[model samples]
Target: WDLVCDSQSLTSVAKFVFMAGMMVGGILGGHLSDRFGRRFMLRWCYLQVAIVGTCAALAPTFLVYCSLRFLSGIAAMNLITNTIMLIAEWATHRFQAMGITLGMCTSGIAFMTLAGLAFAIRDWHILQLVVSVPHFVIFLTSSWLLESARWLIINNKPEEGLKELRKAAHRSGMKNARDTLTLEILQSTMKKELEAAQKKKPPCELLHMPNICKRISLLSFTRFANFMAYFGLNLNVQHLGNNVFLLQTLFGAVILLANCVVPWALKYMKHRASQMLLMFLLAICLLAIVLVLQEVQMLREVLATLGLGASSLANTLAFAHGNEVIPTIIRARAMRINATFANTAGALAPLMIILSVYSPPLPWIIYGVFPFISGFAFLLLPETRNKPLLDTIQDEKNERKDSREPKQEGPSMKVTQF
Candidate 1:
């Protein structure tokens, strides 16, 4: 990097620019994917990410490197957000069935694999090549990627939507799926649903309808807090005075444990409870580290790893809670907006490291404060466990109202089925 950029400070500034690009990409990707169809925009995201990421690895000049990094940041976030949206849309039930433990264990395995790879491949250039080139393989299976069926149906392309559903059904081994999910049946169902929704309120107008706007505004702050603590602890991992690889591995293991613990808690508690608990734990870990390090010097690494773990758990809870809190109609837009704020906070977290020059504890102290306040923010959210996924703003409002009413036991209480 020094050979490429002569100024050390300018290199640091490059990280900020890269984060700016991510913020832009997240919003752009969400909007464009909604307009153009997920599969269509995803192809472009993949192609651009592969090309730009490779170019960034080979950038000969600092300006060129920074430019490529910015573009790569854009491509990376676009790809990430779109892929997540696609997966959430398609794999909601599968993911829920697998539970948090299996999912996080899988993530831990991926992290361990990357760590082992990085350990073996010490050369920066080779590591970059190893990472960048393999991404092109996405194109090989691109043909199998499906356009989002909900996007198709909402955009008045129900025929295309039906075809995709048929393909999905076939994949799930439903022999008579085509006959079962006919275009006529789908159109009738959608027409009835749309008419019911239209009887209450317009989708766009609901954004300004008091409760909904407040939810969005509060969620944005919660997301910002989440990413702030998550990435802050992540960025500070290198400063803990230990072997970097060992620290990272331990952090991964801690995250794996949290993942397992979260699922068990979620089984008995609400998402709001899990989210608040994780945030409180994150705050405790961060503050405890600062206090403990003053007395027990040998415990810094472990406490720091626990802080990262707590933040990781809180991050996952935030994602699940956000999806459940927001109605489906504006989910994409809401998530994109949240991603913009989160990425912005993530970009800013690294700057905290720079602040350590003034006082070593200043950065960690600030990081600890974010989750401390954010834990209370969880009170604003409604519990979503075992509830139907909200399809419209009115549905969310009704749910809020229903929560305030007395509960009826057994079959007397109605359950809305999707």
Candidate 2:
């Protein structure tokens, strides 16, 4: 690539076209996930990776490799989107932060798994094959998976929705309003209550709450900035050298391992505190990029490895945090928009690599501000600690209201888990 670029041949504009493709693909996937349901998109993602990854792995030419890799990027963000909405809606509120954090941690674990694999595999093509197979099986089981209950209820499918809710609660061992234990009873109650509510007035007017647009804008912008920094790090992985593949696999293993473990930690740490802490960690990680390039002579790879893992965890949790706060009726819409901007950020990340042609730190300096400030800003945000995934976008709007008046006057708001 440097050889081609140095000859006044390859241009930043050309490099960024791939990024643009990735961004467009992620936005498209977000909309598709909302329209079809999370499991559908997630299941399809494995198939996509299998096909495109195979093609790229075998490609003998640069053009084929670049094109196939671009296509792979399209399939890339599905795990992020579906997992956020899934765990946010399905996880017990008391453990939602831990759930999302642990979910995010899967990236770490996958990294560790691969580091071990690299000792044996020694080839990117073979490693891709090893990694892609199990995910395909996981995708198949996704066929029997349940859609999100919070999404269903908010979308007004309270009957089928409540059934799924009861199932989730049972699995989580959560006790709720007695009706929540039985779908038949919950639906019967909702059917009568909704009918009665409708007799007086419509349940949800599209325009009843207008601030939704503003909230989406905020969520989208935050996601865009956050992901730009996040993906920029990923995009530049090759800059760390030929051994970067092993480094990345190791990073994924760590993330996946964290996904396996952090749930226990979240059981104790508050959601808001965890998010702020992760954001601060991400900032420090980004800052360390400079130190790795400077002071850490032998440990640069180690520093970058930790930085990558930290960035991924923070990037994921931030999305989980944003998704939970959005009103439910428009949850999909809001998430799509958030994902769109994040993809847009991703599209711009490779551009930062192109800009590295001018000055290496220029991109890092500009990108680093995002995670650093996001942490500070998040510290000022409301605590979603122990808050159950909400039932509806309307429910989110009225979150300040009591489930069934806010002022019960307790030491902490005893948020219900569903």
Candidate 3:
């Protein structure tokens, strides 16, 4: 593993392989979760990560390590995608954003924890083992996790869905859940959604609908920009400070803070606006980092930290907004499309970092430009704040139409003498 002067490029190649695995995972995992169930996919991913990630730590050669890391990346992506979807689907509308934010914040916590672990455990193998072992515990306890009722109902497993709901209700202290939450009641309440689910639309239908297609395109672009900037900054951290651990910890702290601020920020601002503002802030930070004189090392660190926080905020908002806006039936697929864009950026980020060695500001300039344009592009998308999750393509279309149609004055000025 002498990834030095001769094999420096191999480091980037390893990271690229890992991100490629994420891309593959998102594509396959989304389809599987949509066809199977969120809980099942989540459980499977947990076990995969526990086993494969551990093997990565014990890999005998660079090739073996990269291959295992690729597999680990797949499980990691599936775990994250399904975990966020499950949390969003199960939580009450009022808590949906918060729930998603909480799920994401764990990564921030892990980053901080890893900083400490890496500082104490200088052995890379031991550090990897330390991080990978916990997933085994998670996988063991994941058996109790309930499947998403929305997924079950939409997938035409109403009986199983109903059983899950009853269990949820009972756990929430509703003693009469068994009597009150019958299949008839559930079917009647979600009648339109049930009918829509039975239609069994292909994933290609997402591209066929103009409104959804546009939404997905814009979202994917934004995701690409965000990840490229975010990870580019992350990989460049070694250049910012002498103590990489300190910088890593500070980055993690800022990310955690940014995520914590999102639920509150969403309460006051529309999702589109919030994302736009964060992306713009991120652009400013990245561009400013390039402007700062190399002699003033402290200012560079400050700007980098701010950029990291801004990118983290925008990234979290992207996921939350994407879930809220996309219809339930196609949420996972749409998200995977966006995730593909994200992982592509992730794969390219290290390559971009390589550009820094040739001309230090070149990478930041490229990263800054993407988000700057994406910030303004966000204005085109609709706001999803406080809205009920749309369950079908028709529902999304109807909602868009309703938002566009002019509202008539109740009785005061309605077509007088028309």
lDDT of 2 by residue, 285-325 (tens): 66666656544434656665665666665555556566666
Residue 417's lDDT in candidate 1: 86
Q: In terms of lDDT, which candidate is stronger, 1 or 3?
A: 3
| TM-score of every prediction relative to native | 0.84, 0.67, 0.88
TM-score leader: 3
**Tens-digit lDDT track of model 1 for 305-413:** 7777777777766776788888887776677777888988988877776666678788788888988898898898777888788888789878878888987678756
Give the residue spans of candidate 2 off by over 4 A.
Answer: 1-22, 34-40, 79-103, 115-215, 240-246, 253-277, 291-295, 386-418
Alpha-carbon deviation at 195 in model 1, angstroms: 5.7
Candidate 3 per-residue lDDT over residues 333-412, each given as its tens digit = 78778988998898788788677668979988999999999998788888889888888788998997899899877875
Give all candidates' CA lDDT scores.
0.75, 0.65, 0.87
lDDT score, residue 137, model 1?
88
> What is the C-alpha local distance difference test score of candidate 3?
0.87
| Best model number under lDDT | 3
Order of the predicted models by lDDT, top scorer first: 3, 1, 2
Error of 2 at 20 (Å): 4.5
Error of 3 at 269 (Å): 2.3
